[model samples]
Structure formats: C-alpha cells, structure tokens
Target: MTKILTTQNAQITTAAVEVKTLTISGKQVTLSVFRQLREEPLLTEDVTLNGVPWGYVNYHPDKCGNHRRHLHVVWQRGADLLRSTVYAPEVAKFQSVWAKLFIEAAIAEGLTKRSAESFGISKIQIWPHWATHPHLAEFSYGGVSFQAAIREDFADAYDNNYVSPYVKEKAVAITGPHGDAGSIAALKLPVAEYLAVWDALTALPHLFIAV
Candidate 1:
C-alpha cells in the first residue's frame, strides 16, 4: 500500500522513495524527494524564448559545494548559466513547495516558451540569504583572526556585487578557518505561508517584463 503524507499545499506519496505532487497556477506538477544525496537534478524542464531553445531550468537538491543540501534552480544555456536559491539548505522538507515557487518565479519573469527575449526580466531576489552572507570578520578559527584590512576588502567586494578582481584570491586566503560563529539560519515557513509570501513577491510589477 502506498502511504500519503499531506501538507497544506502538497501531497507526498511515500514508498522506497518519496514523490510529491503540487498544484501551482491550476497545474499539477510532480517533484521527487531523494532518499539519499544525489548528484542529478530532482526535476528539469526546457526553457524556450520566441520558439527558440533558450536553455534548461534544472531543480537541484543537495547539490555539492556552495549549493549543498539547498533546493535551488539552475538556468543553463550551454556554457553560460545562472543559479537561484529557492530555499535554504537547513529546511529539509517541502521540496515541492520550493520547486513550485521556482516555476512560478520563472513564469512571472516571462521566461516561458511563448515569451520573447524582450520579455525576460532580471533575476528575482527570493530571499536575503540568496544574496547576502554574514561578514567574515566576526569569526576566528585556527588562531587566525581576519584582519581589519581583510574585512574591509571583503566589504568592498561585497558592496561591488562580488566583482572585485581580487575577490577570489581573498576568498581563498580565508578558506582554512573553521569557526563556530557568524552563522545565520534562514526562516523556515510552512508550505502555505511560504506560498503566500511568494504570491506577494510575484505581484510586484517590476519583477515582470511587458512583451
């Protein structure tokens, strides 16, 4: 017998693995929940612009490196790509809710098949954690304290949208420390509550382009 777990916005079917179904914009979409960490995407769909193949939208969970255990989206077009974090890594459940919001954001940005290049909007800022991080100076580890100059440099790079020429090298310089401080946790919300927030965000006119 297949067991069903119901949430406020989705139904998850449990078996050897879990699969969730959700209703977004009156359409049913399915998402898979992995029993173990997998390198592959949980879901993927093609994105087109003006009837031309623009790229693919990939939904990844527990991805490696910076995206570890985070439910996120990767917008890919050959070598060029952009990534968006839909939900924080610490919120381990409600993968389907995050996926739904990702799709909805894509739709709101007019990245759908029928949309043209002129219809594509700038990237959405779903949450603060998606873009910002705590300053590095607050933590010290391995007897290595981040110097004031280093902290100022990092702040400058961050202020410049992380595009400083020495940003990568500066980041590498601080990689040895393992500190327990300066961690910020994302707010965990129930499926329905998160959806409501997402709805309000999508309603902003600047997030969409008129084609």
Candidate 2:
C-alpha cells in the first residue's frame, strides 16, 4: 500500500512552509525546503527504495549546467547514474519536473512492492520506519514505547549554528507511561538496527509472557 506522510517544524503551522515526505510502504521520498528571505525556498529531494538511496534532486551553485540545479538519479539498483535537465529551485518547478517522473523511474527500475503486513503500527498511529529524531514522533510497538529524541552527536554543532544530516542514531528503552530509562533495557543503534530490534521484539511473543 502507498502512503503519504508529511511534517512541519513545531513553530510552523502552514502546509505551504512544511517539508513534504512521500512513501510507498518502506520506500521513502523526501522533499526538503530551506526557507529564504529574498527568493523561493531552495529544495532538496531524494527517493529511497527499501531504506537504500536511489535518486535525488538538489542545487549546487558550483556545478556546471543550469547553474547546478538538476536531478541526480539512479535508474535501478546497480545501474548507471542519469542526469536530467536543469530545473529551478522553486517547489512548483520541482513538482512539475521530478515528482511523477521519479515514481515512474522507480517502477521501471523494479522497485519492490511491499505488502501492508510487512509494516507495523504503534498505539498512537502507524509510524514511518525510516523517520528519525527531531521530528517529535512518539509511538509504542511490541509493548514497548519508543520516542525519537535528538541524538547528542550534533549538540555542539547545533549550539554553534552548524547542522549536519548524519546525526541520527537510535536510542531506545522499554518503559511504561511514566517510567524512566534507568530501569529498562536501554540501547543505541543506527536506524537499521533499530528497525531490526523492533521486529525481533514483536516476533518473540513468548518473551513477553509473565511468569
């Protein structure tokens, strides 16, 4: 099943200003916007298949052709890289040029069609497995509550006004409504391991039985 998920910064309420994300089962398509005071917000977009990188569109002022605005795409896994025509950084231009075409490209490239059953849901709602911290998402799965909190690796950078995308690492603990991490099995892993951990936790029902 295909699902579309979107999010915005905590202080922002308008949909026009929010980052848009689209997913088809475990596949992810991210459209990120950087707000600008004097022009259209710059955008970076990527499509990932089964948690692996696939295609992207971004602006690099130093690159040749169209002043560095173009789509960098991979047609299939283990396939050659393909570049599309240069595009404007505006959101509307991106939607017109890359959005539907990338979906077609992914289909032609043999992307998997995942079943809904392969995905799980938390008590609150269905959570996107690929989403990371700083998004303020909280959910429970396999009788364990999970919260996506900001990882500390980027703390100093954030304090100094520098930001890095490689900062998300999973830190998980099992607890009740008001329990702390002190009395639980707390551990940290990257996003891949975190998903595996939850799968294992949910599959092992015998371990959850009380003595």
Candidate 3:
C-alpha cells in the first residue's frame, strides 16, 4: 500500500503528496514526494538516509533564482551540502539520476553497494563522473586552468566591472599562467557542458575516490 500526506504552503498549492520507504546500503530511508502548483508546476522530494535528514530533489518549471527549471539534486556531505543540476527531459532520466546520486553518496559514506542493489538501486549513467577521471587532474583548455588552485569570488563583478550573466552573483575564479583570473563562464562552453564542468570542479574533495 502507498501512503500519502498533504501539507499547505502560502505561496503554492499542494497538488499531491506521497511517501515511500526505501532501503539503501542496509539502512532504511524515507522518500517524500510533494507536487506543487504555483506560477509553474513543480515537484520536490525530501529524502532521508540512514535516519538522517539527507537533502532534497527539486524541479522548477522555469528559472527561479539560482535554480534552473531542470532537475536539481542536493545532498548532504558532512557539514556542507552539494548540489547537481541536470537537464532531464524525461521522467526515466530524473529517476535514474536520483538513484545514481543516492548510491554514489551511500558508497562514498562507507556503505556496501550490494545492499543498495538488493534494494533495487541499480547503476545508471546520466552524466560524466569526472570526479574519478584520471585525466581530470591534467585537464585545461580555452586558456582556463582548471588544475590550478580554484577559488570562489563573491564580488559583484570581475575586473573592469564586467559582470557576466552566466556567473550570476558568485563566480568560480580560475587563474591563468599570466596571473589573470576569470570566472568559469569565460570558458564559453555550452550551458550543459558548462554546468557539468562546474559541478565536477567544485565538488567536495572527499566525495570522490581516486580512480
């Protein structure tokens, strides 16, 4: 049997809610689904891992603040949380990405993969897992040095007061050999590729193991 819970929010109307229990890495977890109808219809899922509050999966119809209309998965890692946003056009892709992240996080946390597979969390490839790529350490192109010491700059604009819409408010500072620094938006990659590289480069060090 399926269980459903309903809640109300002042800004959005709750269309539906459903809760399900899932077993991951030998620990029981809860997955709560919320469908909201506002300016645009969106769905959110609150996840718990090993009885600890994990994170959330949110879907926005259009660009909302920093969140794109694409699927956004946010998960906890130690004291901080990491987010990965991907353009998933189909429901199957959404589910696959969600499950893939859950499994990866569980395994990174010293959990056994066999248990998760037994619980039906099969492996799926949605995006390039650059975290474990051997060439990642040597990757550089478009005059941007990714291997160099990367940092985040929260300033309003870069040199010459030039602000890029791609960088939004906060930007990742990548330095060049001539002591020049710029945001990842300077790479001039496509939106999807830019996000992929950004997520890979900014991911927490402990989340990935050497390949």
| Model 3 whole-model lDDT (C-alpha atoms) | 0.29
- Badly placed stretches (over 4 Å) of model 3 are 1-25, 33-68, 79-193, 198-211
Which regions of candidate 1 are displaced past 4 Å?
1-18, 30-66, 73-211
How do the predictions measure up, each by TM-score? 0.17, 0.15, 0.18
Name the runs in model 2 displaced over 4 angstroms: 1-156, 162-189, 207-211
lDDT by residue for model 2 (75-109), tens: 22333222233232221122211222222222222
lDDT order of candidates, top first:
1, 3, 2
By the TM-score metric, which is better: model 2 or model 3?
A: 3
Model 3's TM-score against the true structure: 0.18
Write down the lDDT of every candidate, Cα atoms only: 0.30, 0.28, 0.29
lDDT, residue 84, model 1:
42
Cα lDDT over the full model 2: 0.28
* Collision count for each candidate, in order: 0, 0, 0
